[model samples]
Target: MNPAPKSWWGTPRTITETIDNRKISWLELFSDLIYVVIIHTFVENLTEHFNLFGFITFWVLFLFFFNTWTNMVLYFDLHGQNNLRNLFFALLQVVAIAITATFTGEAFAGHYTGFIWAYSFNQLIYMYLYWQTMRNDPLHATTTRPFLIAYVVGEALLIGSIWLPSLPLQQALIIISLLIFVSTVMSEHRNFDREFKQRQIPFELNSAILERYGLFTMIVLGESLAGIIEHMTAEHTHLADYTHFGLALLCIIGTWMIYYTLMDERKIEADRYWPISFFRGIHRFLIACLTLQSFFIGQTLGTGQLVYYRGLSLVTAASLLALLALTRLPRFNVQPLATWPTRWLVLGIIAILILQFAPVFVGLLLMDLILLGIGILNWTKNV
Candidate 1:
């Protein structure tokens, strides 16, 4: 006799399977609004000084804000019942994220212990919700258990480290944060191992996750663009400097064009054959590149730092754009020398380097031309 079909609540679901049910939901996209505020707050903090302690604190707080929201979204996307209660919970989480952003500076200043408390509390609640979801419908218990433990331990160390009240203790907090990051990463590996062994994740679900990550990348890019516009409006009384304004616009457009031409939609769709773990690793790097680039842009605009006119900013942007291109290239098995696109990218970098010592206007002009050239080339090639 054939085995009876399992009930919906009885059969365990893989992470990928869960995501496929609701790919790119409105709720997920809308939830990222809070992060816009958080990024702004980070920029404000960085503008004050390049202090070591302040930078470290900014990184930790930024990561915490990002990771907490990401984990929550991942959990709900996988396990939420799509009911009113869960919806409310998600909304509450957004509010919590905004609150955390508001107090980030104070927390760094060691004045707002309440913000720390609130952050830790929200994390605990998030973890508890995940545990409840697992209890109700346990799937990949080995992966989930380790992940939860890591989450708990990380939060504990984070909260505990805050109370040390000494510089040594503060330094130790940074170390503990690194450990937390390691544990979180290991948990992902554990999840992948279990998924591979069980053969539960599907191609669609993997695509969903990657696409979600890409949307976050868009958020960072948009934030950077907004910062530039805001700075120009507030600082430059003469909006008549159409040349400088046009170059800035070209730079932004070029960055977007180069990145999207290489990967954007294609990368997400290619998740079926690619190892999800490897894809995630590549994504982390991509996000880092985008974040750093955004930071550079914000620093440039906010401070009038002219780093880009010199070669440093241009090289930095080129290196990141090149890395983004290379990630896409690997999947096609295209060797660097054999690829004209890569050659052009390298030439662009070299030009950027040489232009560093030139007049700022000259450097800007060259960058605009290079980006426009790349954009035109990619368009012609139908990339």
Candidate 2:
């Protein structure tokens, strides 16, 4: 088939290859920096409210930002081109996201005005992008329709939200909009399974998409790294603080090792809907828990709160268990948990949970040791 002709404005690149073998462009990497800033702002906010309510708030906000990022990622991965038009819209998104970040710290409070407008504008931009993608890439119109419709409805809700009298109403409006958007995306992806079975569409996973996920995970893990640095740089530290520092460092490093060991760059045939949906669901939880652990680790080190300490241990255990679940995805390259390492992971989870009842420092020490042991086992096995 002949490629779509470029308009005076621009056109999306055609899908010439079954496997999208393109490298992630510099623009894509640059775009991610804005999201990193957003994550940093939210992390700081999480530090202030390090309780159950705070966690819930952070998770909600995280999902909001994450959904925005995911939409852009899919658009760019599937249809984006490194041209003047793409560059123009990409910069516009950055500015909008930066504006959203400014109001994100207090989005549910008095600052909902700026957050709502910024997010609404962001959705409008995406609406245009997706609409144009469908026009320019008629081959995947079915794939693009759901996204465009979701954005349109989401934008309507966001715009209509401005008329609401109270923050509670506005918050409710925003959450409902997100829920609708997610439901639309999920429903469309479910169609992918049927389409794949009938050979109506080619729905294979690509390396570029996998690489993007890995990059996002690395950026999220930086929150924990920042916490480690915060601990190291504090003044008036004692030997116990030093011990806590060592354990925190080991735990963060071990987390990184386990993640990479399991989520290596192995392409999967994401033809069926459920496997891809489950892969995404697990990753969202995994990253959210990892970010939560960063704060819990910091709070445990500084304030020595039993709640924070327990949170640290439990999230760490849950993260590893999540990785174990990822290994079970049939289409994913990683096999089901190896019996030997599976035993260690189970034992580690149990030990880590049990040790939380001990003194903070003692529990942290034992938990870190177990994590490091599991990490070593994973690394050596892969080697």
Q: What's the TM-score of every candidate structure?
A: 0.80, 0.90
Against the true structure, what is every candidate's RMSD? 4.8, 2.7
117-185, model 1: which lDDT tens digit per residue?
778777776777767756754665556677788777777776776677785776577457645743474
Instruction: Give a tens-digit lDDT track for model 2, residues 232-254.
Output: 78743587778777777788888
Model 1: lDDT equals: 0.61
Which residue pairs in candidate 2 have backbone atoms (N, alpha carbon, C) closer than 3 angstroms, thus clashing?
A: none
Best by lDDT: 2
Q: Where does model 2 exceed 4 Å of error?
A: 1-9, 15-20, 108-110, 194-202, 331-334
- lDDT (C-alpha, whole model) for all candidates: 0.61, 0.75
Candidate 1 displacement at residue 362 in angstroms: 2.4
